[model samples]
Target: EDKTASDLFKHYQEIFPHGNRNAASHRWAHFVLQRSTQMTPGKVAYFFASFCPISGSPIDPTPQTAIRYESGHGLPQVSGGQAEGIIHHCCWPCICDSLKFLRVDTKTVSTSQGPHQFRFLVYGNPCTDPTRIPAEATDVTCSNGRLEASVLSDHGHVIVGMLQDNQPSIGASSREVLEA
Candidate 1:
């Protein structure tokens, strides 16, 4: 089904009802349009993350964690089934601090804490025209680094492992899944 801005906004509202009623969801819907090929409300609901992976903070109504992403591959398995994709968010401060030492030539974002480095990868041809890039993207790679060992919420022992550069981490077992 072709996802319209209305569809996106409606779904976002269903999942995050307390968020900004119109403006914020409208903006978020517009942002998703650029990156997704087959977008649907179900997909949005399935992929959206409630917290910022970097700061582990609850995503704000304006979604202060402006850096949002959708990764369709390379995520840990979940109990219900494999996750088709992950929609994750991150704050600017957390991402900027992590990318300060990024070596673009080597596709690595290193941190000052030590030898920790993330292999950042882009799915398509690198965008040569800065103007062509989406205005919401913080970096070309759309990811800074593995801000934490895990990005999953405290919904029991449902999450595990380090998140891939562009993908958010989620590990679920049967115990963590509730029948819908």
Candidate 2:
């Protein structure tokens, strides 16, 4: 988001004057510029803080500070009859050095033709619960994360991998999943 046209142009120029920005190879260079926008809407239902699960660094800053994390991981868990988001310390620098996945989980299916292997789709988004922090690793806590999704205006507890995007309501055919 911080990148400006000049910053991108400089990096582009380094090779562009030598590499054609366009397909006008016969004339040495040709170019086309393009741009687009994306909108991912999320709201903070509540606000809370605690240490990052992965790095164990105390992150609930006194001044409510936030590290400029290039990215982070969220694991959703249920506690006290409520759903919670557990923040993993997957921020930039630590992410570069840490092991993102401990193991590869695969599902094997036997069909009439042969055995097919399918990978699990794990969708993890930033936690929207602001007031609840995950119990520390050693604090007798449930750190297991699972997927959860819901459509606009749906206030139901959705099971991961069960609901499709933009579903209008809960129904009997929730188990009918589509393959990606």
Candidate 3:
């Protein structure tokens, strides 16, 4: 049977009583529909990474990590176990890149050990616009021959890869990584 938007909305409300019918929530619902229509049901995997000159403190250098994602459209809601597995499997490279990006420092610090003193900064959100880094997050600096990157969102566990200066690196992987 065909369902109207309102019908779907009502069904959703019944399923997610806690959901607020605000603009953002409505948009999110629409986004789900759009993504579902475009996607073919199948297993998928992805990976990402970045490098920075700074080094995280041995004690607590890594930044706080959080995964923001969504699953389910035509299919039943993903179980907690499934979601946990997806997050666990997908979050590593992103976290690693984030740590790498946060550690780059332009001004060199003198240490008792080495000529270059590298300190790691906590990774924050990712941004398409490099001009704006999340307020709580530090900027990824690439001066003095250093670069760093952090993962912001891997919503669908899609893989993305890109080449920078002819170096092959994983950008975002969606299906290819899973196949591998």
The number of the candidate with the highest TM-score is 1
lDDT of each: 0.29, 0.22, 0.23
TM-score of each: 0.21, 0.18, 0.17
Residue-by-residue lDDT tens digits, candidate 1, 15-83: 334433211222232233233345333333322333333333334322233333223222223222222
Task: Give candidate 3 regions above 4 Å deviation.
Answer: 26-31, 34-180
Q: Candidate 2, residue 97: CA error in Å?
A: 6.3
Q: How far off is residue 56 in model 2, in Å?
A: 4.5
Tens-digit lDDT track of model 2 for 38-103: 111110100112222234232322222222111123222221121112222324443332224211
Question: What is candidate 1's local distance difference test score?
Answer: 0.29
Q: List candidate 2 segments past 4 Å from native.
A: 1-50, 60-65, 69-93, 97-137, 140-180
Ranked candidates (TM-score, high to low): 1, 2, 3
- Tens-digit lDDT string for candidate 3 (105-179): 111222223233211122222233444533432323323332232211222211121111111121222321121
